[model samples]
Target: MGATPATRPTSTPRGLARVGDRVSFLYLERCVVSREDNAITATDDSGVRYIPSATIGVLLLGPGTRVTHQAMSVLGESGAGVVWVGEHGVRYYAGGRALTRSAGLVEAQATAWANRRHRLEVAREMYRLRFPDADPAGMTRRELLGGEGDRVKAAYRAEAARTGVRWVRRTYDPGDFAAGDTPNQAVTAAAQCLYGIAHSVVVALGCSPALGFVHSGHERSFVMDVADLYKVAFGIPAAFDAAAEGPEDIAGRTRRALRERIRAAGLLDRAVADIQHLLAPYRRADEEAAGGKAEDGTDGGVRLQTDRDGTVAGGRNYGAEGVW
Candidate 1:
């Protein structure tokens, strides 16, 4: 379903937004003030708070997600790549919940990438198991992409198809970079930011990020579930951009540098914004179906008119949408 810590995120401060901090997760309906546990428990506007403020440090205010602490905790514990709730009722999905968190960023991203290599190896071995003549010393990311960098786009879509999930697809166009374009410094920088953003969402949504679509282990199945969606789409492009450009301009030359630079790059906020928007409708649906309320404190479920199948009439498609 996703990537593990080994999946190579584009961010530093491994597990950014880790546990033990206080949090303020603001949703369209209510604001949550609490501590960040494996799950970030929230205080509902109904004046019902299940978490203590001392454990909360992060104030996630914006058009993101709102979920029960119980749900958030699930994502956090599993090393989820991204986790979020709908406005109130639709869903509280946690991607990449089945991977390992043994290493920090450089190590983690390296591990994820290494694991990718190992996965290709294992695939080769599996093929050998059947064919008995498959090459064992062969396999490369280039081949994974059908020997063309452009094939990365297809690799992304094909992987997402496995989970019946669809995420937005993007290309790093010239429009993506204007004057002072960081192409010379983008790969590493972007990777780190992506990791941080991915893990943050994973924890919030209750998914473990250690497991993966291409790499699955028992340690972090849920985390893998989500991370896979971003690894190639977000992680690879970032890595390729910087790696493909001048490789000598940056100062620090370690993967940590890669992580830090990526972290420094902007757009985690935009990613968060996009994640929130994607989550809003689902959260609302889940909440309303269970009689959740809105910021106005009005019951939404009571008004929802559904067909016999329990699916809302004239409602936007939620489950059917796959990786974009």
Candidate 2:
């Protein structure tokens, strides 16, 4: 009898759709990841082990990890984000695309962001959610920014006092991590960690990380915005605690502590919910308009409508323009 050839798996593992699903972050150093038996396998100095790619939110590739083309393909298909970081996962260099293909949420995000008034409304909504005890209804963009800054300052001071970590000021040079003071470095590391987590969730939810309400310009502006919303609750405390531990292995310590805090607070699901809530007003408005039109017997076949500037009105025309 002739020898049989090895065959690839017919299907890849499906990623999590809902935010409540259990997803984990895998950090590997000096390892090679490859596809084996329909699962992602990582080979390091120890041995080879399977990685549940579908349930992974982000794969943090630090230092000497080599990823095969097949492994990358599987991860891409599974909607898992691959982030390249520096030693100890302190610096984020690049990332892969989100696995979600839904255009409805993306369209709604663009529509809301493209309009100035709607964008302000979304910003206000974010502020309200972040500070539920206070009212941001009458606040302007500048006022909101001021309030947020004050709140963040207070959070840093509070966390410093709680953790017994000295607080002088927040100063850090991203290019040179060592130049910053201990607390600064810890804060930066913690924020970066939160940003990575937030980015994974944002991508998984099928939303644009570029289009942001309070933040703009950067590629991961939306990610920063979302992460900022929860920083007072997670990042600040994690940084302070890590700083209190002294400078020995600060990066690794901060990462581990932040991960524990995130898990304990159910941060992933909260992030997903916050994204949905931030975009909910726009989604609700569209649904209500559609419903109202339907009730008035004006249910014409959906057609592309544009304003004077050629911006898509009543949500994007996904068929003609493609998802933004």
Candidate 3:
């Protein structure tokens, strides 16, 4: 689901693909892409298009597209966007119609591979058992994450724990629960890492990022889902010691540093393994959501499972407007 680098659809896509780059996108119908010439063109197909990034206008995720109205309004308002990629190869526009207001979604089941007795599942299961009251869908993101501190501290107490005093700093970093991004690089970095891992997991499972157990929409979908179990693995100790916030000016800089840290952790790899195990469950969810198979075989081919990406792939069978 990633961009051209991690096999994402775009080329040179820190934000969007650059012109003269070879791109492979599936959700073209979700929006109108403005090319290099400032000419805007609406997309419609599950088909992959190699448009010069410069020639792209807005990447249109049109009416029949599964994007959200909030997203529609947002993207319609702004001319720029970022393509997001998860560990399992999820690649889609970060600010598209499906997740304009909500940002992005990675819908997948928590128990997609619950039956597996592997070490990863075992570890995840142990984490789940810690909070029996927690919902698989993430009914209480703020509440659950708020309580993660204690569980994180408990991990420090574990005899098997290889970490030491530094773990304490991570657990109690004041920077973790702040507003500004720059002032809290450590905490922000930890959160970004956790979210990146969670996003990757959702894509691999082929679930919708926007759907969650406790969460609904607009606040990042699968982020809440996997973050519940996945984020705690790293941040419990690291973010705990982070400063509450930094200067407002350096906020964006701090976020960049945070992204670097998250990327260095290689959490995406772990999520990929975990997500692949859940594929069977996600497929079932997809089927149920679609109310059986696609009338003309729309979903299940494109790996990202994003609203607009699905719309693009659907173009081959359905019309450019994503009609079946």
How far residue 176's Cα lies from its native spot in candidate 1, in Å, is 31
Instruction: Report residue 93 deviation for candidate 1 (angstroms).
Output: 22
lDDT of 2 by residue, 1-324 (tens): 322113444231232344446454667778998986446899988899997667677787877889888788766656667777674325664354544433446667898999999999999988988888879987899999999999989998988888888899888775777788788888887787777777887877778889999999999888888888888888888888999999987877887888888778788788877887777666635444554233334422233434432223343335645532
TM-score, candidate 2, is: 0.81
- Number of clashes in every candidate structure? 100, 0, 74
Q: For residues 35-93, what per-residue lDDT tens digits would candidate 1 score against the true structure? A: 34333454554664444322322222222335545444443343333323222222233
Instruction: Single out the weakest 10-residue window by summed lDDT for candidate 2.
Output: 4-13
Q: What is candidate 3's local distance difference test score?
A: 0.38
Candidate 3 worst ten-residue window by lDDT: 96-105
Instruction: Give the worst 10-residue stretch by lDDT in candidate 1.
Output: 98-107
What is the TM-score of each predicted model, taking all chains together?
0.28, 0.81, 0.37
Candidate 2, pairs of clashing residues: none
Off by over 4 Å in 3: 1-93, 96-149, 153-189, 200-206, 214-221, 236-261, 279-324
